[model samples]
Target: MTRKTVRIAMNGVTGRMGHRQHLVRSILALREQGGLELADGTRLWPEPVLVGRREPALRELAGRYGLERWSTDLDAVLADPATDIYFDAQVTSAREEALRKAVAAGKHVYAEKPSATSFEAALGLARLARDAGVKHGVVQDKLFLPGLRKLSRLIDSGFFGQILSVRGEFGYWVFEGDWQEAQRPSWNYRTADGGGIVVDMFPHWEYVLHELFGRVRSVQALAVTHIPQRWDERGKPYDATADDAAYGIFELDGGAVAQINSSWTVRVHRDELVEFQVDGTHGSAVAGLRTCRLQHRSGTPKPVWNPDLPVTHSFRDQWQEVPDNEEFDNGFKTQWELFLRHVYEDGPYRWDLLAGARGVQLAELGLRSSAEGRRVDVPEIAL
Candidate 1:
């Protein structure tokens, strides 16, 4: 088998998600696993060059990982003819400019969601990549997750006879950075810094619903900052301008209604931090991050609606668990492999920049709906 090496310039890896998920678990893990095998019996190896703002962090990460390449100069990295791919995990505000430069540099581009701060910019990036003829993709990691994959299999097997509605709950309380330091960065709560539950999570919701259930036709959302004040990294209080919580109702193309609540203020009460309950004509399924349980029409218990009396049926116990027949890989890593295949052998990759633009569009429309206090229709986009 011929060995093919592709150099990847990874940006903004100092951030938590960038560091852990993309750089460590996805890219480096693939390297440690002897690279990815392509369809043509070629072992496609990844050579990652760390690129970021801080030189100290980049050098430290590279040294810790035994990587030789680490650079604070994005322009120099992009100018290198050896760089085959440019991956961005930067903040929403910084993403567009960097991506534009990457596309201009004639490099394959892959990045995290909400491609840009606004729908227009995101769409612009899609157009740019399309016109530039570079193999582009977005990190739609949720679709590759174990629970969602099982749920998708159920959909494929016609387990849900006629899909009716979906209910999603996602959130966990983030500390105010006072006594307990904030788990999330302070920029997440500031609107100027491209922060908000709507902008951050609506993109994920868009792709998940579009891929698994149906395309979102319209959205109505109530976005608000539940906590007005929060301490920054330095333990200084700042007015949290971004919306901490968002309650959204989405209408899908196939007549399915999806209601999702995303927040950073609410405490988790479910099996996972994020969970989706999908109901259909024949059955209903609840899928979390790693588990899926379903109850068919025949197995579903009929309960008496007596408010004054105690509930008799074991509702939670009624659902049957979906067993994992196959081992599940890390979602981010799985996507990375697929993207690599797409770049090398011209493999089928549907999650392009346009899909990412759709996600950003949903987020933009969601925020608009909240501000106008009305449902906003999602318009189709074209280059």
Candidate 2:
């Protein structure tokens, strides 16, 4: 098979998501597997240059991963004509300006969301990329999840006659870093650094709900900082200005409502860290990160809310497991391969920068709903 190398300038490679997901698991894994196969007996190879602020960190990462290229100066990498793509997994606050610069330099751009701190900034970037005539994309990794894929299949197969509502429970307890070390980074608790549950999880919920049901028409949210203060990575205490938990209700276009509770302070009680239960007229299904269970109308048990008597039937045991028909890859890697195909081949990619802006818009609207204690309407993004 003929092979083509697409040189990628990857920024924020020193960060957790950037280094692990984008660099190692996706791009490098593709290279090790002899590149992505195109339909026309051709392969696309990802050639990435590690770009970051710290040269030492970049050098260490490159050497550890057996990479030949590492650059601290982003401008220099952008100026290089060999760089075909500029990928960013940096913080949401830094993504907009970096994307602008990358687009101006005539490179295809892709990044993690919420793409920017605000909707205006995100839509502007989308518009700018469109004007620059570059292929732009955003990371919507959850859509490719195994469980969600199954759920989508059920939807497509008409397993549910008429979907009614969806309830999503996501999150696990994150240590305050006093006695035990925190799982997430310290910046996630700081609003000044663009960290909050509403901003982080709303984007995921928006896309998930839209993909499963329809576009979100409105959002109502309640946000709270459960732990007002927490210890940082250096063991220093700092005030947590961002919302640690967000309880939101999104109204979809088809009159379906999705209720989601996202928090860093909550304990997991489901099959996975995140789970979604969709109730419909004909049947119901619950999906986690890697597994899905379904309950048909004929198989569903009748339960009576009797406080006087002890429960006899086990509710959890009534549901049947969904069969896995195909092998599943890492969700991040799946999207990366599709993005590469969209960039090089004539692959149909709908999750563009405009789609990303919709995510940002949902987050922004969710915050507004929380602040004003009212439902906020979501407007369509033209870009």
Candidate 3:
């Protein structure tokens, strides 16, 4: 049986995430890794039709990838009978409208995280996709990271017996764009563009926590803008309206707690910028980018409160380095593969719009908590 080739129409193909991460890293790189073979034992390569506002940019991208189909009109691409799926990596502000259009056209949809800025908007998109009977997914890429995979294994193996809490330290110093060029997009600092760390990242935490422990019952958080101004690619300065940092505490089911500190201002002092420390009754584990350290209760040395003594026995000793099992690719690419597999082969892919909405919920609640000076209970998704 010949496998059905999935024709993908990518909206916002020239944007930062669209060009570097989603298009180049995910779609192109995944094909290089090895295209998907369906359940019927037929091979398929994602045939993409690049859609964007700029013709020259689209042409350049298309030519670079040997893509024959490219267009500037999104509606035309959506209306094309050849398009099997619509992939969106557009800005958050543009996502709901584009997704609604695609779903109305009866196309399967795959999109980047924080599907929309607000929870209600995300829920509406989810309902639209469901009503259209289209397969839908949002990127939840962190779960595929090797370090997180190892952490999940530890949790599943009962290494972290009666898990008490989890701590995450995520961020690095981002350039101000005045002296040095900003590492992220300039639009990220603008609220109207759907830019903020809480909205951008909390969904990632939601899935991670849900996967590792359980559902998050509530969240208490504070979101702040550390840098008030930033420069764009062209060196133009703009007011930074989005929060650059977020401190959040998630209350998980079964009484476990997760604390997430996400910022763009902190300096990285370890192997990777992102790290997680898990503490349980039996033992504790600290996982950095490629390495993990384990300290069992039996090995935990008791010491008096001394300010001068070297803290040697506290969680230390590097475990074996975890090598990348999949072909070298960004986290987004790995997630893209999973979504493709889910769509074509019926592989397990639970990271749907509901999951995406949960992230938005966290961000919304976090902002509310910060403004109201109180904790916010996370609301359950309607569907």
Model 2 TM-score is: 0.98
- Sort the predicted structures by lDDT, highest score first: 1, 2, 3
Per-residue C-alpha lDDT of model 3 across residues 1-383, encoded as one tens digit per residue: 56556799998888887888888887887677567666777767888899888899999999988989999999999998889999888888888889989999999999887898899999888888888888899888777776777777778789878999999999999999999988899878888899988888888888888888898999999999999988999999899999999999999999999999999989888678889988999988877665566777877767588898777663344343444454534678778777888877778888888788888887888888988878888867777
| Candidate-wise lDDT, in order | 0.94, 0.92, 0.84
Alpha-carbon runs more than 4 Å astray in model 1: none
Native-referenced Cα lDDT, model 1: 0.94
**lDDT of residue 284 for candidate 3:** 85
CA shift at 16, candidate 1, in angstroms? 0.5
Q: Quote the positional error of residue 373 for candidate 1 in Å.
A: 0.4
- Candidate 3, residue 186: the lDDT equals 82
Q: Please list the residue runs of candidate 3 whose C-alpha ends up more than 4 Å from where it truly belongs after superposition.
A: 1-3, 309-315, 318-330
> lDDT: which candidate is best?
1
Residue 121 C-alpha lDDT in model 3: 92
RMSD of each: 0.8, 0.9, 2.3
TM-score of model 3 (CA atoms): 0.93
Predicted structure 2: lDDT? 0.92
Candidate 1 lDDT by residue in tens digits, 210-320: 999988999999999999999998999999999999999999988999999999999888899999999999999999999999999998887778899888667899889
